[model samples]
Target chain A: MLVIARHTLRETVRKRLLLAVVVLTALFLLLYGVGSELLARQIRERMLTNVDTALPLAASMLTLMGFYITSFLGALLAIFVSMGSVAAELETGTILTLAARPIRRWEIVLGKWLGLATLIAVYLIVASLGILALTRWATQYTPPSPVPATALLILEALVILSLGMLGSALFSTLTSGAVVFMLHATGWIGGLVEALGSVFDSQAMVTAGILSSMLVPSDALWKGASFYLQPVTVILAQNASPLANPFVSATPIATSMLLYSGLYLVACLLLTVRRFAHQDL
Target chain B: MTVAIETVDLCKQYGRRLAVDRVSLQVESGEVFGFLGANGAGKTTFVKMLLGLVHPTSGVAHLLGRPIQDPRSRLPVGYQPEQFRLPEWMTGTETLELYGQLSGASRQDLRVEIPRALERVGLGGRGNEGVRAYSKGMQQRLALAQALIARPKLVLLDEPTSALDPVGRRDIRDLIRALRDERVTVFLNSHLLAEVELVCDRVAILHEGSVVREGRLQDLLKTSTQLRVVVDAVTPAVVEAVRPFAHAVVPNGRSLDIELLSPDHVPAVTRALHDAGAQIWEVRPQQMSLEDVFIGIVRPRENG
Candidate 1:
């Protein structure tokens, strides 16, 4: 299993797509690096030299914006990397030799899943932490709860990875990736509907949104992360700002939502194992 | 004699498609067993079923005394799948190393075997080249080498020579023969009848997912008992005289092709032709080609 996991990691990490993504990510970080330096210099000058200037919530808004961009990219990268993990092997008949070896089918699934999961974890930690640290460096302000918010964001990416792998079991690699992305987009739409339903106090509208979230908990995880990243005062400001609506939630995600995310992960993983075990190559 | 591979009423289905019907077969230890079939005849499906790549819809397969699904059962088994694909990023040596790890070979064991396996398949010193750089025939050789990496007791090769040149095909045939000499049971699945004829000790012909014929190659082809004779200065009298002793006679380019009732009739036919003032040039029993036997078994029943 370790051999398979290591080999799987080697296979995915060596792809040109990952290299392109890494290059893009580096460019993104460089731009942020320069922006953060300028913002930090500006904050120091304003806070020390100038007084009586009403400090706008630039840090808070940037925090939300940074996390949103990084998190969305992270989620998409996770899906892109994992979309063909097993499906490509099955399609190209590359899995035959491995499947015929002394290893069991479930080991292949679990090993591959472990490699992708570990990849997403490392990526989430480095990119998310780097983004947050840069934000803090720029504005000298942090989120209300950094650790929980980061954990939820990581979970959101993992949820997408899990669904991508699950889709790979039933469809071709590209189709599975597309399906996971569609489901993710649907969840975002659902989260928006639920947020609107809350403001209007419409149970029917809320139920419709909640049903989609139940199918895939990507939006729930994001909403949960947003709840921790923004304080109540910032939420009030966000409610008034139409531009900030995508990243803002009226209330913290319910604790039950976390349970659903956990269950969704296990369910997708288990189904992948069972389906791949019997699937023809 | 121990059975290295045995299947009892094995079947595989794809929706309404009966890919592999209730096919039963047994291959004894050290036998080079050939599996022949037409397109979509379920040869690959059966092989996959035995290797646990495809779940059996019913029945059972045993390899080296354990059920097919049991991983331990595959410890002594090596497989070269049809249209084999290896990770293109890996060198041939790395590919072997990976399979070595999967086969649970110790470092010492791999150390002793890797170079020898590569050399055996005629890919010596080219192990460092990435598979993406290998030509199709070279890649095929490397696939065979990986199957030999663990020194398995049974090697299942599907279309092992499908991508090879004439020399490469001969190399694979010689390799199969060498495996047979080493007492390794080989399940050779191929549509290449000539190759099968050269190496197989036993064969099973599959038609429409069923084993239409199974027996020792010699026994299955024994009934082809035809003697071809070449004669010089032969006339209609020589042909007519030879016809009495031969069950059937065909004349082409100064040679009379005689279908002998048995081996005993060969001497008599030669004597009759010689007595007719025909100078006998050459005479030999016509061994049935694997292609003929295969066509006989796999062609539609109405044609037969």
Candidate 2:
């Protein structure tokens, strides 16, 4: 299993896609740093009333925005990297010799999952920290619980990664990518609807959103991370506003929902292993 | 002799189509066994079943001594698939190392064996080159190198020489012979009948998902031998006299094509022609090629 993991890591690192990812990540950090510095200066010059409250709220929103984009990038990387992990090998016939070896079929699935999971973890850590450090430097504001926030962010990416692998095992590469991407989009839309429902105090809309989140808990995970990353003052400001926003949560994510997301990740991985083991290659 | 491979009523059905049907065969240790079939005749499916790549519908197969379902059954086995597909991003050495590791070879041992395997397959100095940069033949050589890197007790090669030039084919033939000399079992699946005829000790011909024929190479080919005789005169008396010794005789130009019961009947037919007062110009023996045997078995069933 470790051998397969090493091989998978080496192969993914050597791809030209990784080079593109590195360049784009650098460009994104530079842009965010410049944009935050300008925003911080504007807030100081223009906002004279409630300066303490407005400044921290603005900085927290900027940090949340950075993390939001980071989460998006991380989810895309996870899906794209894992969507072809098994299906492409099957299509190209490379799995024949590998499957015939003495290793168990579950090891192949687990090894690949481990490799991609490690990549996603590293990306999340670096991108999240980069955003946090830049926000701290520019605005002198830091979230109360960065560790749990980052952990939740990492969990969201892992949830997507495991789903992508399951899709890879069950469908063709194109179909798997489409299905997983749609599931993620559904999860994001569900989060938006739930936030809107909360603002209007509509139970039906909230229930509908909850159902979609049940289908794919990625958005719920992000909401949990959002709750952790927001300062109390920012949460109050967002709650007072009449409009719904994705950057701040009025309530923390339920512990039960967090437990469900962990189980969902495991179920996807287990299903992937089972399906691949029985498939004819 | 120990049996290297055995199957009993092995079968694989893809929906309504029976890709393999009741294929029961035994391959003895240290022998070169050939598996022949036309397209869609289920040769690859059968091989996959033996390697646990394809699930059998209803049958049992054993590699070495363990059941096919057991992963350990493949520990001492090596396989070169007909597709010859390897990860393009990997170097040849890396490819072998991955496979060697999967086969349970220690990293320390692979550090020595990988280079030796590459050298054996004519890729000694080219091990560092990525497989994407390799030509088709080079990739084939690399594939074979990976299969042999662990020095498996049984090697399953499907069309092992399909992508090779004449020189490459000769080199592979030599390598197969070397493996045989090392007392290794080789189950070769190939369409190159001539190559199979040269290297295989025994063979099984699969036709329409069934084992239509199986035997020692000499035993299968010996039954189709014919004697060709040239006589000075085409007379009814000579034909009538040799009729007792030949199974069937057909006149072709100035020669009589006679199928005798055995090579021992050759001298008897010659004496009979002499006794009929006919001058014997020349006598030659013709042995059937493996191609003839394959076509003869598959074509008739196909037509009927």
Candidate 3:
């Protein structure tokens, strides 16, 4: 398993995927720093009576947007990297030699998952921290719970990674990519429905949203992270408003939902291994 | 001698069609065993079952005395697939190192063995080149190198030389001989009958998911029922006299190619020819090539 993991890492690097990711990440950070600096400058020039409250609100909102985009980048990386893990190898016949080795089939799936998991973890840490640091540098403000927020963001990416890997084992590369993307879109739409439910006070809409989150908990994880990253004032304000908005979570994800997401990740990994073990190559 | 591979009534069914039908075979250690079959004849399916790449629908198979389901069974086995696909981004040495480690070779052993394996396959100093840059023949050599790097007890090569030129095929033939000399069991599957005839000690010919023929190489090719007889005269009476002894007789310039119904009729045909007053110069039995035997076995079944 270690050998396979090492080989996977090496292959990813040699294919230049990692290099492309690094360049794109650097460009994103540059743009983010410039944007945050300009926003901070505009707020400073306004000279409002409640500048003290207005400044922190503006900074937290900007930081939340940065974290949002970081999470999006992380999720895209996770999906594209893992979507071809098994299906591409099988398609190209490269899996024949690897599968014929003495290692068990589960080890192959887990080794690839570990390698990609490491890559995603590192990217999330760097990108999330970079956003937090840049926002603080420009606005002199920080979120109340940055550590838990970043951890939640990483978990969200991992959940998507597991789903992509499972799809790779079960379908062709193109089909796997399409299926995982659709599931991800479903999670995002469900989050929107839940927010609208709160605005309209509709229990039925809220229940449907919760069920969809149960199916794919990517949006739930993001909401959990958003709860950590938001200021107390913003949370109170969002709760007081009757308008629907997808970005702010008035409440944290339930403890049960977080546990379910963990279980969901494990289930996806186990299913991938089982399907690959029984599949004919 | 110990049995390297043993399968008893093993089968594989893809949906309604039975791709492999109750194939039972035993190949001994240190023997070069040839698996012959036409396309879709279940040759690749059988090999995959032995390697545990495909699960058997029923019955059982064992490799090197361990059940195929046991991962340990493949610890001493090496395989070069017919498709011969390698990770294009990896160098030759990296590919060998990866496979060697998966086969449980120590890092120290691979450091020494990788170079030697590459040299054996004629890759030598070119080990650092990526596989994407390699030609078909070079890629084949790299695939063969990885298979042998661990010094496995059994090597399964499917169409081991399909992409090679004549010289490369000869080199592979020589390599097989060298492996046989080292007491490694080689289960070779190839459409090149001539190469099999040159290197295999025993063979099993599969037809429609069944072993139609299996025996020692010499026994399978030795003295078919066709006999060639040279006569001094081209007499009508001589041909007429031997017609009853043979199923068909084609008269050449000075010889008669007679297809006998059985080997028991050899002496009777000689006597009849002598009684017709034709002087016989030479009489010999015909030896069938592997192609002749394969066509004869597969074509008839196909037509029927």
Global lDDT of each model? 0.84, 0.90, 0.91
lDDT of 1 by residue, B1-304 (tens): 8999999999998899999999999999999999998777899999988888888999999998999989888899999998789888889998999898898887789887999999999999999999999999999999998899999999999999888999999998899999999999999998888888889999998888999899999988876657888888668998899776667888888887887766677778878888888898999888888787777555656376
Candidate 2: segments with Cα more than 4 A from true spot: A48-51, A239-247, B230-232, B240-248, B259-285
Ordered by lDDT, highest first, the candidates read: 3, 2, 1
Worst 10 residues of 1 chain A by lDDT: A49-58
For model 3, which pairs clash? none
Task: Quote the positional error of residue A107 for candidate 3 in Å.
Answer: 0.9
Chain A TM-score for candidate 2 is 0.95
Q: What tens-digit string does per-residue lDDT give for candidate 2 at B88-191?
A: 99899999999999999998999999999999999999999999999999999999998898879999999999899999999999999999999999999988
In CAPRI terms, model 1 is classed as: medium
Candidate topping lDDT: 3
Candidate 3 off by > 4 Å: B234-237, B275-277
| Model 1 lDDT at residue A205 | 76
- Cα misplacement distance, residue A63 of candidate 1 (Å): 1.7
For model 1, what is the error of residue B253's alpha carbon versus the real structure, in angstroms, after optimal superposition? 10
Ranking by DockQ: 3, 2, 1
For model 2, the DockQ equals 0.82
